[model samples]
Target: MSRRARVLPGFSLSLGVAVLTLSLVVLLPLSALFFRTAELGWARFTQVVTSGWVAAAVRFTLGASLAAATLDVFIGLLIAWVLGRYTFPFARVLDAVIDLPFALPTAVTGIALSTLYADNGWIGGALADLGFRYPWPAWRGFDHGGWPIAWTVYDRIALAPLGVVLAMCFVGLPFVVRTLQPVIEDLSRDVEESAATLGAGRFRIFRSIVLPELAPALLTGFALALARGLGEYGSVIFISGNLPATEIASQVIVKMIEVNETGNYADATAVAVLLLGASFALLLVINLIQRAAVRRGAPG
Candidate 1:
């Protein structure tokens, strides 16, 4: 190829710059985190990571992020389809609104979510009422022998861990939405129509034709959202009520910074390493799953 036709000139210089940028922006910070963690030595590091508090935070953080990411894949695909496949009032506005989480400050998002979901707040009050409702009226003949059935919906929902999942869903949704939208928009209707003509149901056509095409994007989006949720702090802190049940790895680190004396972040670093390893393990699992999915879907 002629020099004029080249998209990027001087491959060596471009490669050098890219490597330099990656090292400075990513590697340096990660190295520092690892180095600080090493200062604690093996036994202390193990104790910090294996503590009850850390265990609870790990369980909640991992579980909530995984749930949030899984929910986002479905919800985001639906939203992407709606916005891309149909035209309606405020369509453009809705498209722009999808990026709000990215642009808005985390603190503001937390406060807003917390205010809306507090026990006395609008949505929270409704949930409390909904949860405590009776299944049948007292005047009704059967009425399960006059015993009032408590649904306990709010008890299951309004917990700190559930709140963490909610906050993660809000913050991480954009990743799934943005990742899948373009593919959804570009989807050709021919395969769908052919499947339909062959007597395939709407769900069947979607499953057999459309879903395989979307699987890679869905997995990628899920991975991104999962990573984002794992690292989330500000938005989660408020909405999750900072309780032990909802306490995340980030909160544990922050508390360690304050209570563990100045310049002493051994525990915090240990927690960071735990988080780093968990993120890597999760991502590796996602990658393996993605490859298997692609292979299964591939044509012989």
Candidate 2:
């Protein structure tokens, strides 16, 4: 067929727009980071990024992000499966609500999480009745070993690194769920039915037939969630109590700039450059994986 349809502008025009958008939205800020960081000599940059506090923050940030992203993979797979494969009352509503974290402002999310998990809050109070609590002080106690314990579901998660993981899980959940939903929906039940007919148990069928197909999407979602978790700030600051001990890498940068009278912006940029490099590495790998997945006719 001669002169088949073209829905959009010519390639040159489209490419120009894409480059402009990318430069303004992403490249310019990143360039500023490097430029500012260059002001700090290599020795100074290394000292700032490799300091004891910065090291600790980096370790905790990576650890918490990994833990939260791993948890999200399991939880998201289960939810996406249910939402995509089943019909139930308010199913659509539940599906819609899965993205609530994305739609809500991070500050609002911070406030909500802090309130819900506070000692006197609903979940916290119920957990208290069940003997789960955090030891706060002489106030809000249940007479345990002469120490005053406050109501919290976790033994020590409230205002700790574990709380960072919790906040990350909340904000990053939608990525995993949304990523896997399409894959779940596209899954052919015929293979599963045949496996069942061939005497495969539910678990066996799922493990052998479904998991492999979902694995790629799971990885992509995990990477995405991990990236978001690493960069998280507002919600995590609230849930994690902003303790110096529980500070993440982003907080380290913030403190470096804001904590001092002189405000070490160059030092902070040095640390940020490292983080940005790492996050970009992760995203690059994810993009390659996504492209490979698409080539293999798999849902992303």
Candidate 3:
């Protein structure tokens, strides 16, 4: 009989602890959600998920998340590079500033954004002066100023979605920055110097050499940002104007819960199931694509 070398004692005990923790914290709750959702029946489940409002909320949430994540990648890269590569005044302060969103309460962020974008607020005032209006009309035929005004001011852009995007972007920025900072610091500047010595332009060197290395970390950050944006409720609820079609999926879930307290538990669980599935699917796809890209970039 072969004798096994023991790396550490109490392996069985450790495994038991881990199993217990998983069961109590993650598995149990997720199982409950699944169990509750199962009670809805396939037809009701489909109806809840396939409703037009649900579809619209999903589209809006995903679209906004994608947009925010895309923006985060570039901005995060810049911020990380600045922090990792250069010494500047207030460097530490700037580094700390990047984490403000993490420290801020989401509800506070939402209220602050809403205030800044409301009709009488600073940003809103300037926008209004530039032909935008606040309390934007509810419907098409409200008549802006009587005599059927051709180009109503309030008919212009609304900032609620923009506020949500901004809030999410602020909160999500640090994820990308933190992920990329180490990778960027580890990069060999010698490679870029060699490329430049070989007559490559600045843009060419960055496009060819820098971006590929950064892609994986960037994608990871994008996935994090996208995930956070999808589940975000407090930061989005107040600033999103809480309007149907415009409200996020989380907000919709809250409203559903409020509609019928008795069914709230089951309906809320159902919505959670849907959101969970979507989040899982999106992260899986992004990860797979990133892995494929990384493999393709590797030497054969």
Candidate 4:
């Protein structure tokens, strides 16, 4: 038999291109972050990372990201299930529309969300009328109107921590929905039918069988959403008001360089290094859990 010509580059050429691309696009920029941090020396780097403002920003960013990812798991799964299993008018359009966030500019998303959630905006006005006003004073650690902690927390929905969560959810929704949709579509109906035939209730089957099968995909989606939320800036910036020691996000580290009185870049990069390390560690744990779930669900 005659040998057929290859349609693509050989392994050596392909590997070279891959490495070059990775170096240019990912490695070099990430290395710059570390290089800048190293210039600060150990003491200065630690001080920057341990600053009160940085701590507050870290807390707000991580808290909002976790909350948004948790919500996305439930909401995304429901949406994916409906789209994957049901037939309805404009269902395809709805599915496509879930990706609007991915396509829309982040600045535009920020502006729109800020407009919708601002005190004088349509949605914001109705929410404020319903007594959902943000507790600005409480956010600054003052007792406003003797409000309870719970109510104060609830009131901080717009231009506060909750606003950051909302923006995170808006940006992260597509990740969860897109991840889960395929896994949901690939699920075997026969397995569900067999469970039903065995007298298993809908909830029972869902909890016992469906959930286990979907766990890995769900975890993957959660990781993606959480990562996206953690790094989010533009959308969150507008809605959160970026108040220092209140609703500031981790991404504000970059802004620190721009706005710092001494024009120090090292402080910003030190914060970036810390954020990167924490994010990588968390992602590693999540990925391990996902892999374990996948292995557990696999047939021996």
Candidate 5:
């Protein structure tokens, strides 16, 4: 047999460069974070991470990120379907606009969101007037025996837990939309048509056929969005009101660095280590789910 020619020159050199860049930009920083946390000693690290305020922040951040990512799954699927299946005036423009969150500065997005959702601002004022509120009655019940399970309608969104969720959703939306777009585009309409011809309803076709095809991409998008939302700070801080045990996010660790009192650096780095571990675990779960979905969808 004849020898095959190489596809590209300098493959070794490019690989070396890529590895070096990744190490310098990503690996080194993460390694340093772990090293700093280790310096705190295991007992102290646990003490800091398990502190009441830190625990509260972690709970709130995790909850908000999950809620936002879940919301994005539906919104992103809708937008991707529209863009992939329909043609209309400004369709291209609308598609382009979906990436605005990715391109815009986090601070700018934070400021804009804060402005738009402030109590006196456009949407917030209307909601406030309608007497809307998001009451954690279950939490309240934990503290105070038996609170009524009434749903408070029309709560103001800004500077609340809702604001944190909104910020997360804003920043995470692009991840879901972008990840799912190509998958949606690549999906064939023939399968759907055949199902319809077999007397299947729209919902049945979507549930039995479309959903399986889209599952892996959807999970990947959700993972990416959730990861981003968990680490988000700039936009979240502006709207979250930074109320400890309420709207505070895990990124408050960064603020602790500036203060530096009471061994804040050690505490912050320890919290970071926990966040990193949680993120790794979550991503691993998502990857396993994606792989399972792909396997199930494959022809046996």
Candidate 6:
């Protein structure tokens, strides 16, 4: 039997440092939140969660985040393709621009989008010429009928739902592109060439080969974007009109703590816990899908 060597490097030391960092930075804060929330009895916590407005807000937040993440996935893929495949002039400029949302303050993004989508705003005027009306209710402060129904796309596209989505796409496009860009660049073009030689169409080659390879990364990007949009507050608040049932997950938690006297810290903590649970569940599902994809990719 071979004797164990003592020459191994500082793996234990590095791991200890990492654990300490995570505990101080992440676990401690999260534990505090849960501990504070525990002060709310189960009945109160249940009431906070099951409240009609809270329910609606949850639905809207999840729905908008999902829609935004989905849209980001496609646009991000396109951008990634352009960045990786085509070398147009100013490509580097475009590359840098994609990361702007990441660096820009969320409040700044909210203000900018609110201004752009306002009734008399420049972009809003053009869209209005195309027959767009404000989508939110008047109480929400956005002029209703801002965009015509055609521009609405989905039935719920109006309201802050769509605005939140737009903001999310702006912030999230980079993650998707960055995740998939390397994979796309390293992909073997010979597969496409060989498939084309076999009389397969471009769409067929992409459907059969490209998409499968991209699926894992696509799911990863989707998860990241969805998580981000779920937690997004500043960029969505102004554009979303801050209406009840239209506000996002994080916004609801903040409002409960800040606005309503009846809202206890426990209630705020409960809602946050719910959001965290949802995010955790989503990540688990995405990871499972990724693992399945990897298994499928393995040689039989």
Any idea how many clashes model 2 has?
0
Give the per-residue lDDT of model 6 (tens digit) for 157-202: 2244666778877777788988989988888899889999999998
Runs off by more than 4 Å, candidate 6 = 1-9, 133-159, 260-263
lDDT of each: 0.84, 0.83, 0.80, 0.82, 0.84, 0.80
lDDT of 4 by residue, 1-300 (tens): 997788888879989999999999999999999997899899998888777678768766787788899999999999999999999999989998999999999889989988988878888878888887443222233234443333344453566677777889999999999999998999999989999999999999999989999998899899999989888887877777767634554556767866857766778788878878877988899999988888877889
Please provide, for model 3 over 1-300, each residue's C-alpha lDDT reduced to its tens digit, 9 standing for 90 to 100: 996887765789879999999999999999988998999998988888877677668767877788788899889999999998889999999999988889999898888877887667778667767876434222223334444223223322234556667767877888989889999889999999999999999999999999999888888999999899888888887777787635788987888888864647676677789999999999999899899889988997
Poorly placed runs, candidate 3 (over 4 Å): 1-11, 132-159
Local accuracy of candidate 1 as per-residue lDDT tens digits, 173-275: 9999999999999999998998888899999888888998999889989999999999999898888777765788999999998984584487888998899
Ranking by lDDT: 5, 1, 2, 4, 3, 6
TM-score of each: 0.88, 0.86, 0.85, 0.90, 0.91, 0.87
Question: How many steric overlaps does candidate 1 have?
Answer: 0
For model 1, what is the error of residue 26's alpha carbon versus the real structure, in angstroms, after optimal superposition? Answer: 0.5
Q: Candidate 4 — what's its lDDT?
A: 0.82
Model 3 TM-score, all chains together: 0.85
State the lDDT of candidate 5 residue by residue for 151-200, as single tens digits.
Answer: 33336687677788889999999999999999989999999999999999
Candidate 4 deviation (Cα RMSD): 3.7
RMSD (Cα, Å) of candidate 2? 7.0
lDDT of 1: 0.84
Which model is ahead, 3 or 5, in terms of TM-score?
Answer: 5
Steric clash pairs (candidate 2): none
- Candidate closer to the true structure by TM-score (higher is better), 1 or 3: 1
